[model samples]
Target: MQLGKAVRLERIMNRNNGRTIIVPLDHGVTVGPIYGLVDLRETVNQVAEGGANAMLMHKGIPRCSHRRHGRDIGLIIHLSASTSLSPHPNAKTLVGSVTDAIKLGADAVSVHINLGDETESRMLADLGAICSEANEWGMPVLAMMYARGPKIENEYDPDVVAHCARVGVELGADIVKVNYTGDPKSFVRVVEGCCVPVVIAGGPKLENELDLVRMVHDSVQAGGAGLSVGRNIFQHPNPVKIVAALHKVVHEDWDIDAAMELL
Candidate 1:
């Protein structure tokens, strides 16, 4: 890795633990300003104050959420998006460039790609182009790869998840985010298949907070680098406390029971 990229990764990942907790707040473009997203600065502050390593958002969000004074949190600009209303919502297109993220002072840039979508080729091409540009600038790239297509019967199947993660690494992503395969045993294969760090997405909101924390714990046990969860963390009744608990679990190796005490 380039010195510049290494330096930037340090901002979003715990250098001591090689783990991270990134809260994604870029859902407004995909689902329209949903709850937890309307008050950008406050939400960002709350998450950051709770010790989230980074917050991922669309290019324009920093103008609203970037704090002049507060606990610092790394920024990751999401470069691709697709509205939920779109018939082809699974197909993500690049709406921001690596140059745009750099100008906005981002620590990293992320792109979403649905591996089995009809427009998979286009999204892959976009990812390749973005990776090339990001490499030139020494900007880290996180690829959110999912198996969301007609052929994919179970997106959470370990093999499917592993393949998605490997695609991200093969395409040059610094980190790959995929759905957890439901258990440490299955998820371990997902992590081992990818050369780069692998992280799990929160998926839909879970029924209880413990489930969320347990998922993080299990993923980490499976060798996942950490998490890039969105709704579960930010949309929780107490985002700050949950994040702190996650921090303990991911970075401090706290037991799930101990981490849950923060909630």
Candidate 2:
């Protein structure tokens, strides 16, 4: 890698103790102002102060997020989306380009891919093309891989989830964001199979805080570099405390019980 690219990667790795704690505020494009993220800046500030290393958002949010926050959280630009109200919500379309992301001063750019969906082929082509472009720009790509098709009833199936993660790396993603397989042993397979660093998605918001901490702990134990959580942190009664707890799990390698105590 070139000096600039290597520096950027180092910055990302350094932020979360070689692991990552990225709080995604890109929800507005998909599900406008979902309960907790109504005020994006305030929520981002709280998490950033609580030790979050990075914040992922669509173009709009980053346009306003402060550059000199408590600890210079890295910014990731999400380039794909399809709102829930859209006619084909699952068919993600490109909304921003890698060049646009760089122009926005993004440290990295992310794309969402729904494997096995009707529009899978189109999205895959886009992903490959975007990866190529990102390579030339020396920009990192974070692929959010999820299985969603008629055949995929349970995304948690070990084999299916593993395949989804592998495909993301194969498509040239620098970092693959995937769902946790409920157990460290199974999730370890997914992480081992991917060529690039693996990170776990927060998925939907959970009702309990401990459940979220346990999931992060398990994923990290399974070799995941870190987490890309959204609703789980933002929707919590105390997002700052929640992030601090998660940081302990992802960065400090604390167990669920220990991490929960921080909350």
Candidate 3:
């Protein structure tokens, strides 16, 4: 890896603990301007102050996000997109390139790949090609792998989730973001199968803050590095407090009830 890329990766991965806490704010492309992300800058500020190690956003966001707030939070540029309004939402196309992400001053780059979809083969091909290119550029690639389609029985299926995680690493992702299998024992298989570091996605908004906290705690206990939560943190009444509580679970290893008290 190049000196700059190596330094960036090292900075994102906590040296004291090999895990990471990445707050993803690229939802605008998929779900439009949701409640929590109505003001992207404010949301970014909240997560940054709450001790999130890194924040992932699409190209436009980093360009306008508060530079001071970003000083502490490593920025990752997401390169793929599939909007809710689109007829085929599962088809994630590459909207940006790694070179463009570098020019945007991104510390890393990410792509979303939907497994079991009709377009699965094409997306996987794109992921593989991008991973190879990123390797040459010395840039780290985060793969957001999700199971969704007619063939997929359940997103939480242990076998299916494990295969999704493995595919990301096999395709060359430095870090894999996937959905947690409801149980810790089942989720462990997913983590164990992946060669790269694995993190769980927040999925959708939860009914309550405690539910979200418990999910994060469970994922961590199951051997996930951390979380790439979006709506759960940003949509909460107090994003800063929510992120702080999540930090306790992810970085401090606190239980759900204990972390909820901090909220």
| Reference-based lDDT, each prediction | 0.94, 0.85, 0.85
Clashes of each: 0, 0, 0
lDDT for each residue of candidate 1 in 1-263, tens digit (9 for 90 to 100): 79999999999999888899999999999999899999999999999989999999999999999779999999999999999999999989889999999999999999999999999999999999999999999999999999999899999999999999999999999999999899999998888889888999999989999999999999999899999999998899989999999999999899999997777
TM-score of every candidate relative to the true structure: 0.99, 0.95, 0.95
Candidate 1 backbone collisions, by pair: none
At residue 83, give the lDDT of candidate 1. Answer: 97
**What is candidate 1's CA lDDT for residue 161?**
93
Q: Tell me the tens digit of each residue's lDDT in model 2 across 1-263.
A: 66666666665665345688888888888888788777767887888877887888888776566645556778888999999998788899999999888888888889999998999999999999999999888888899999987778898888888898888889888888988899999998998888788888888878798788888888888888989998888888888898898887888888887886778
Would you list the clashing residue pairs of candidate 2?
none
Candidate 3 per-residue lDDT over residues 1-263, each given as its tens digit: 57866777766767566678888888898888878777777788888878888889888887567556344788889999999999999999999999988898778899999998999999999999999999888899999999999988898888988999999999899999999888788888998898778899888777888777887788889888888888787777887888788888888888888887898
Question: What are the runs in model 3 whose C-alpha is more than 4 Å off?
Answer: 1-4, 69-71
Kindly provide the TM-score of model 1 when superposed on the true structure, using C-alpha atoms.
0.99
Runs in model 1 lying further than 4 Å from the true structure: none
**Best candidate according to lDDT:** 1
Candidate 3 global TM-score: 0.95
Model 2: number of clashes? 0
